[model samples]
Target: MVKKTDVLVIGAGPAGIISALTAKRYYPDKNILVMKDVKNGCIPCGIPYMFWSLKNPDDNKLGMDSLKKNNIDVILGKAVTVDRENKIVAASDGEEYKYEKLILAFGSNPIKPPIAGIDKAGIYPILKDMDYLKTVIGELKDAKNVLVLGGGFIGVEFADEFSKISGLNVYLAEILPRLLGNSFDEEFSVLAEEKLKEQGVQVLTNNKVTEFLGEKKVQGVRFDSGEEIKIDGAILGIGAVPNTDIASNAKLGIGKGKGIWVDEYMRTSDPDIFAVGDCAEKKDFYTRRRASVMLASTATAEARIAGANLYRLKVVRENKGTIAIYSTYVDGLVLGSAGLTEQSAKKEGFEIISSASETIDKHPGSLPGSNKIQVKLIFSKHSGILMGGQVVGGISAGEVINIIGMAIQQRVSMSELETLQMATHPYLTSAPTMYPIVIAAQNAAAKV
Candidate 1:
């Protein structure tokens, strides 16, 4: 049957929810509907915290109140296929939706390792599903020893959360030379690993999970280094696979990196169909290469573009390409990064000059809760343009690197950051004289 809406959004997480709300606001007279695969979705970013940090799994439940208030329809069903020519979406429940324009905000799924015994009863992969999470949590509660199968942020966060149990044993394993190798430099990555170590979590890098032992449930893990660790449960957080099966099945162009290819306005090959969130392939702001950077921040940006330009010509205010900018806390230290790392810049064949500064977050240094802050800025030696940056220490580290991300996005040069204006206070920020970004840029300028 033909049911129609002015705009239809898929997925109800950050991207889908934002797109539905924005579309309704932009075109208030138009009917908008958001189809959610998850009957009740948890906050995407807050899923890790729910393992132990939250008292109840439902604590992270996203309310449909906003959609109802905005007069946008929210449909609870999985999108099974999209027909661009016909402008219809076939949901798994056999409900069909017809749309004048559609926004694809379906997110990603965890990429399970090819290692044997991955299907064992005690093995679990992190997906944003609530029922799956509840089952995993129930199993973890009875597990005395847990083997975390990746050293990425999700893996570490899971390991740390699981470690909250008094007698729970947690071990983190990574195949990279260092944990968070793709996100931060060795120094920052090493510091994060060190903190996890102090948290009573085993840190193993430069190792591969070769096998999982036991007939039904995971009893132990074997590493390529000939090391075996006994455990009752295993959680895999290695990486994500974009949920682009519908896109691929529909014959939309997929990128070399395996995500649905999208342009500046989040438009897929078939302009009638747009893809967003972790399911969409993002381009690097600087290099224009396919970017593997996946974050809710990036997803929201794409949603804005898709919502605004769904039926109209592209909007110029926002470029869909994003610099990889993100921050996460490990143990008590906050670590953040934007653009490329020093090593990445060198490997990318750019002549790079870098500088760093170490200082306390507070000017007086006597503040009760003051934390030390370290800032490093990398730049093109020839042009003095900011290429990337890394910052650790203090809670503000979460947002500080975003300042660098913006700089990189706008291609701001060292000269711009050196003269950057920032609000400062002993209680809220670093002293004016030692503002982290400006000071870090100053040091990089000196080297250049």
Candidate 2:
């Protein structure tokens, strides 16, 4: 069957959904269609919580109500090939879609490293599909000892969630020296390790898994140092690679990071097509260098830009670059990082100054539900412009890092942050006199 649409979006993940909705908003008269392989999609970030926090995998399902409400057509099929010259997308089920404009949001796939016994029945890689995860969750209910490989956000979060199961021994192994090495400094990383330890999760750092050992199912893991840990199942959260096979097959320009190359306007080499989300290549906000950061927030932001400029160019709607901001909760602590870390900035050969301050989240230091909040801000030593920031604190830290993100995005200077005015309340925020962000900025200014 032949079908036609004004705008065709592939993949129904965050990027695809947002692109369809945003396109409807900008070009109300245009007919938009979204095609995805999976009927029920799981929230990418919430996948870890399905083991315990969420009642079931279905609890984290992404609904199609929004797509239906916007009058967007949703098709269930995997796109097999893209005929860019003719603006036709061929699906696996012998269906063809013709469009005037196309947006690719094919997302990504989990990185499955080749290791001995990796194909064991008890081993699972985190996937965004609901049905696959539901089966994994059912199997995990019987698993007493589960090993989680990799210490990034997904691995750490899964380890924490699995630990919540009664009598389940959760072990998290990271090849790096610390958890969250890519997003945070040692100080913040240490705090995360400490939190996970408090939850009774075995935190293993600077260790690499040599092999997954078992006959039919995973029974244990052998580390590089000749140490072995017994386990009933294993979850691989090492990382992900972009799903760009179709795009590559179409002869679209591929970026160094193996994602579809896109310009500031989110347009690919072919002006009629655009790419967003995990499938699209990203550049660093500071260096303009190709970056490998992928986040749903960044994806949606790119989608908005692509949707706005789908037909006519919207000069103000172009994407500047990815800032790589991230936030995660372990136990009861909230940790967030935005822009570059002090370690990363120094590694990039930028002379930087860092300042940190610790304060209670509420005034008088005695309010109910108050907790200690720690703030760290990084600035260029010569330019004194805000380069990055990290926060470790109570729930408020989640939003506090966003303020710092805004600072980094706007290139706000240290002096400006020092003199910045913010609203505060005794119960809702830190004391106005000793706000951590302002104090941290003041400290950095003094260093300058």
Candidate 3:
């Protein structure tokens, strides 16, 4: 039997949901269906918060009420295969869906280290399914010693959250010399590590997990240098693997980075097929090189573009590139970064001109609850254009990186930033005379 729909979106992640909703908004009468492998998948970004911020697992649930309110059908099943020629998708439950346009928002999977004993009962990888999350929560509730593998955002966030539980021993390990080495500059990395340490998290750098030693469940992990650290459980947050097997089976062109290759319009090799989210390849905004960024924010933006242009290409958003903007908060301190780090910039063969400024987030430095703010700007010494930026400060750090991202996207010259106007208040932000962006730009101006 043949099922019909105007657009079929597989995977009800942020990208999938946004695509379906956008399609429904644009084509009100069109049929829209979303297939999610997990019946109850929590929002990926909110999963780490289950440790401290959220009292219960249900707090992280991504309610489907918005989708239901929009008249979109959500199927609770995994898609088995796609018949591109027939324009149909077959679910594992013998159900079939036919669509005029197919959007594969199937997100990525976490990369589980193939270490011995990883399959033990106490090892947990970052997963979207809420069932596993509940299991993890139960296990961790009684876990006194928890080891977090990796120092990326996920690992750091997990460590920060788990460390909050009274009496729980939390350690965040990384092979690199700095935490968030891939995104933030050294100063910001140092500051972040300091904050993580202050939050009762044991920060370990230049270390790697060698083996998981346990009989029934993880008891401890062996370091590469033959030392061992006892732990009740382990959270592997190294990286992720994109979900592209179905696309591969359907002969979709995959990029060298192992993500599905799509054009500016998000169209895969097959004109009728499109890929977005963590499974899709993206270009670097500054370097024009293939980038492997998998932020939910990036995915949703891509979904918006893909959904709006799926029917007749109404929007003209080219996947011009990804800035890889990233942000995370811990114990009320927010850290944000955009584009490349100083190390990455140098590695990419660019002569970097960098500047940083540290001042109070609020004016007068005496405002109640005021905290110090640090901003770093990196630019090409020759071109004098903003290549990257990092901010460690106030509650606004979460959104402040957008300015840096925009600067990188627009290739804003350092000279143009000196005269830029930014609003500020004595209670809310730094004085206009001490604006971080302009201040950092001015510092760069001296050397450039």
Highest TM-score, which number? 2
Tens digits of lDDT, candidate 2, 136-218: 98888888899999999889889888878999999999999999999999999999999999999999999999999988988
Candidate 1, residue 108: the lDDT equals 89
| Native-to-model Cα distance after best TM-score fit, residue 48 in candidate 2, in Å | 1.0
Model 3, 182-260: lDDT tens per residue?
8877777887799889888999899988889888989999988888989999899999978999999999999988999
Assess every candidate by TM-score: 0.97, 0.99, 0.97
Separately for all candidates shown, the number of backbone clashes (residues 3 or more apart, or on different chains) is 0, 0, 0
Runs with alpha carbons beyond 4 Å of true place in candidate 1: none
Mind giving the per-residue lDDT tens digits that candidate 1 earns over 1-448?
Answer: 7678878888888888887877776778889998887766778788888878898998988788999998888878888988888899998878788988888887988888689888899898877878878888887887888988788777878777776778888898899878888878899988988888888988888889999999887899999988888999988888898888888998999998788998887889988888888999988776788888789988888888778777775557456477778888876789998888999888878898898988888878788888999989999898888889999997978778888888887788999999998888888778888898888888887775
Lowest lDDT 10-residue stretch of candidate 3: 311-320
Clashes of 2: 0
Per-residue error for 349 in candidate 3, Å, reads 1.0
